[model samples]
Target: MITVIGTGTGAPLPPDAEAALAGAGLVVGARRHLAAAALPDTAARIVLGPLAPALDAIERFLEKLEPEKPDERRPVVVLASGDPGFFGIVRALAERFGSDRLTVHPGVSSVATAFARLGLTWDDAVVVSAHGRDLRTAVNVCRAHPKVAVLTGPGSGPAELGAALRSSERVLVVASALGSGEEGSDEEGAEGEGAGGERVERVTPAEAAARDWGPAVSVVLCLDEARVLSPVRTVAGPPPGPAQWALAEGDFTHRDSMITKFEVRALALARLGPRLGEHVWDVGAGSGSVAVECARLGAAVTAVEKTLDGVERVRANAAAHGVDVSVVHGAAPTVLSDLPDPDAVFIGGGGRELPAIVTACARRARRSVVVAMAALDRVPAVRGALVAAGLDCDGVLLQSSRLAPLPGDVTRLAATNPVFLLWGVRPPARSEGVAQ
Candidate 1:
């Protein structure tokens, strides 16, 4: 059996952890952890780096005890930071050794401690791990939400986070080497400021990126002052979805029927499946009604507009709704290449290059793509582009009408133009459990 223990950010092993180490025949951890653990003289220690070797060593130790009596085998302890199960080595260990053969003891996560030091509750904050991953998603989350926590690591540390968030208004509260036991929060305002041991301080993204913050940072809290605490609620984490979507055309500024109807936008949103951490492009964003609605639904959206007035309209609509919709003032097909690949794409206004835009979006979309067309002539080519991109193609034609009051008390149906909504989803990869 394998025992994975979380050594809190501070040193000095707890009683239970000490007991495990005292009897451990083999130990696997980083040099810092190994040096602080003061393991038994007889125990075999492997300084962790390039995880495969350490896991292999543990496997060898476990194999040697295969024929020994269960009671005769000494304990094996693997030390980790915070919760090993949370984006740590425990996953690799469990995958190699099986969950049934492993036991885990968790410590306070660095994110939790950072929030605690601020005397704030985090039930409303979205926590994202940027460790060894792109900062774009995290940056977008910070831009849209009021409060967020980013788990920092070598490549995705404060400097990188700061540079990406330079345009955003979030004040970064960088928590460095938190809970190091070597320093106390009360000793100074910013614990790790210059002491180089442990500290916490608030700085603008521009300042953070402009200078070196050293390498001791454990986590960074990106916060917008206006959204610190939500109106009293029972639930947590981004509240819930808006009560309504696919808002009325009058609710947004548009270029005279140039915007998609509420009925079509509703179906398109459902097909696009926009949600947190996903990027959706609203090409030819006229007044950006569809882009605004998608942003309101919590997806990171980039509104691509060819006209300067249309770009301003999208920005105004986004500001009016209290959401972020990055307005790219350029036409599609060409502009699509430089932008980050999207999880979903909404082709709202593809002009003469409609087919090429659809092809480009379909090629890069990670999840699905939705295209709307008022003209029947473009449907065939759009469908062809989607199907040729190895996606599952499906479509629908929607026509709706509302009752209008006339001179009398009686009412008459006002029919709207019919729109064709075409969409496709990427086929599941063969490596996944889904049948190919």
Candidate 2:
């Protein structure tokens, strides 16, 4: 049988795991795990680099055991860091060998260790992995939620994450060398010093990005200190979401009828699919209603507006909803170049530059783009922009009417101006490139 043993977080290997390691004819793991275990010099070993070959080696070892001669078969042990099942090497092994033929020994995950070091509860924190994936989503989670744990990878480490979230109020807790012998070896007699080899350094995003950290960083905990005890939640990570979305016009303080209608916002949000670990841009955000709603739905949001008054309104609206939203007081099609690419984009008001803004947003949107326009003249141009960006484009004109009280006791329908909402979705087979 193939056995996977978890080896880190300062936890001692259980007796069964030790016995398995001792008897293992073939031990496959990283060099550190092998050295720490002190396996017999005679035992065959593979220093893990490219994991596929290591798995192949394990498969060969397992093949020798398939014969009817059970006595001749030798044990194959795979050592891993943290609970292998938790984004570790066990997945690949289990997939190669049937679960029935393999046994797993799990230990404390580094994420758990990091939280424990800070004496914080993680049932409410969202956990995401930037390993072998994108780091922007992890940054979005940090912006939308109070807390999150990000599993670091080659390029998606603390520095990258910190740079993305530098403008946000969240703090980066760089938990490095977790469960290692030299965790807090030299950085002692300081205010924010760690107790041992497991050191957790809390710093602002700027501070985190300024230094060059070692490769020992296993996990980084991005936290919002203001939300530590915001509320007692029954569920972990993001909450179940608001009972309803596309809040009414009266819900937000807007000048004249500048806000996007509830009907349009609802449909826009549906096309955008804003959620945790995703970023949504509300270009030309008027009163920031759409931005606030996106943030409420657990998506990191940025409202880009050129007017000073509009910027203040967006900020006030975000504050009233009790959610953090980055308010960029600048015009789009220019400012959007520097901001992180978005999973979705909603263009509410781009004025004469509507087509340019739509094109800019479409090019950067990784998933989908939705645009709302009242001027029929802008529909073809906006649709053309999305189509040019390789997004499958479609649109509909919406006409709404409210009941108005007549003089006697009768009522009549008061029609509002018809609006056109054009949306485009990137094909599932295609991947969007990040625009510098």
Candidate 3:
């Protein structure tokens, strides 16, 4: 049997974990964890690096144990940081040996300690582990949500996170060396200095990216200071993805009745499939109604509009809906080069450059792209562009009529203009998951 103990996040080892370590005949942990513990002189130690090797070592140790006399066998303990079950070594161990043969003891997560240092409640915050994973999802989550805790690892550290968030107005709280008794300096008003070796510092994204914050960093909190304190949330994790989506035309601020109709917008949204930790692009964002709706659905959105007024309209609509949307004041196909690749894209208006814009968006979109057009002439070109970009193309013609109050106490079906909604989905093999 194996015992997994979570520690090193400024918490003392529980008595249960201590007792397990005392009897451990073989111990496995990171160098820091092993050095911090008092292991028996007879017990063997393995410094963990690449997990497979350590698992192999543990397997060898377990195989030598006499299965019939379980009580006579010395304990095998693996030490980990924070909650071992949370993006830690427990999963790997369980998969190799099975859960029935192991016991676990959890410690305070770095995310919880970081938030506590700032006197903030983390119930409304989204916690993402960027350790050994793509940083794009964490960046997009920080962009879309007000509060986020990122578990940093090597390349995905505070500096990298700060660089990605340079354009965004966010305060990064870098908490390092939690519970270590290291001396703290007053840089950036570092706090929590007393007996605990923790240093909590606040810096802007630019400031954070400017310096090197060694291996001591425990966690980074990316917060939109304006909305850092959210209302009491009954359900956690990204605010439950907006109660309703595909809002009505009257709900948004548009110009000259120039917005995607509710029916067309509905289908476009369905194809886009916006959700937390994903990025969506709305090209030719007229009035930004579609962009606003996508943002409301908890995806990081960038609304590109050529007209300055249109950009402002998109911003206003996003603000009105209490969502964050990066409004880019420029045309697509050219402006898209500066923006990050999106998981999904919605092209509403592109005029003569429609096919070019669709091609540009389709090539960069990781999952799917949806194009809405009124002119049948552009349909073939758009479809060709999607196909050339290696996307599986599909389309629909939406013709809907809404009930309108007419003459004398009666209602009539008002026919709306016909729209062609074309959607291109990347094959599963080519598609990227949000957590990637």
lDDT of 2 by residue, 1-436 (tens): 8888876567899999988888878998766677678687657998876778888887776766657877766688887777778877776777877788778998778788889999998888788888778777888888888888888876787888888888877889988767777431111101111234556799999888887766677788988898776478787766779999999989998989899999889899899999988899999998999999999999999889999999999999999998889989888899998898899999999889999999999998999999999899998999899999999999899898988999989999999788999999999773579564
User: Model 1 — which ten-residue stretch has the worst lDDT?
Assistant: 185-194
What residue pairs clash in candidate 1, if any at all? Answer: 191-199, 192-198, 192-199
Give me candidate 2's TM-score against the actual structure.
Answer: 0.90
TM-score of each: 0.81, 0.90, 0.93
> Which one wins on lDDT?
3
Which regions of candidate 2 are displaced past 4 Å?
Answer: 38-42, 182-196, 403-412, 428-436
* RMSD in order of candidates: 5.0, 5.1, 4.6
Local accuracy of candidate 1 as per-residue lDDT tens digits, 1-436? 7888877466456687778878899998766667767689999998776778888899999889856588778878997776677667778988899999887877666777889989988889888877667777887677667789887666676778898778677899998767774432211112122235667889999988987766567678999877786777678778587899989999888777788999998899998988887788899898899888888888878889999998999999898988878888888899988787888999988778999999999999998999999899999999999999999999999999988999869999999999999999998878768675
lDDT of model 1 at position 187: 12
Taking the candidates one at a time, how many backbone clashes does each contain?
A: 3, 1, 1
Q: lDDT for model 2, on a 0 to 1 scale?
A: 0.83
Reference-based lDDT, each prediction: 0.81, 0.83, 0.86
Please identify model 1 stretches exceeding 4 Å from their true place.
11-13, 65-72, 98-101, 132-136, 181-195, 201-215, 250-258, 306-309, 330-338, 350-364, 380-394, 404-411, 424-436
Candidate 3 root-mean-square deviation in Å: 4.6
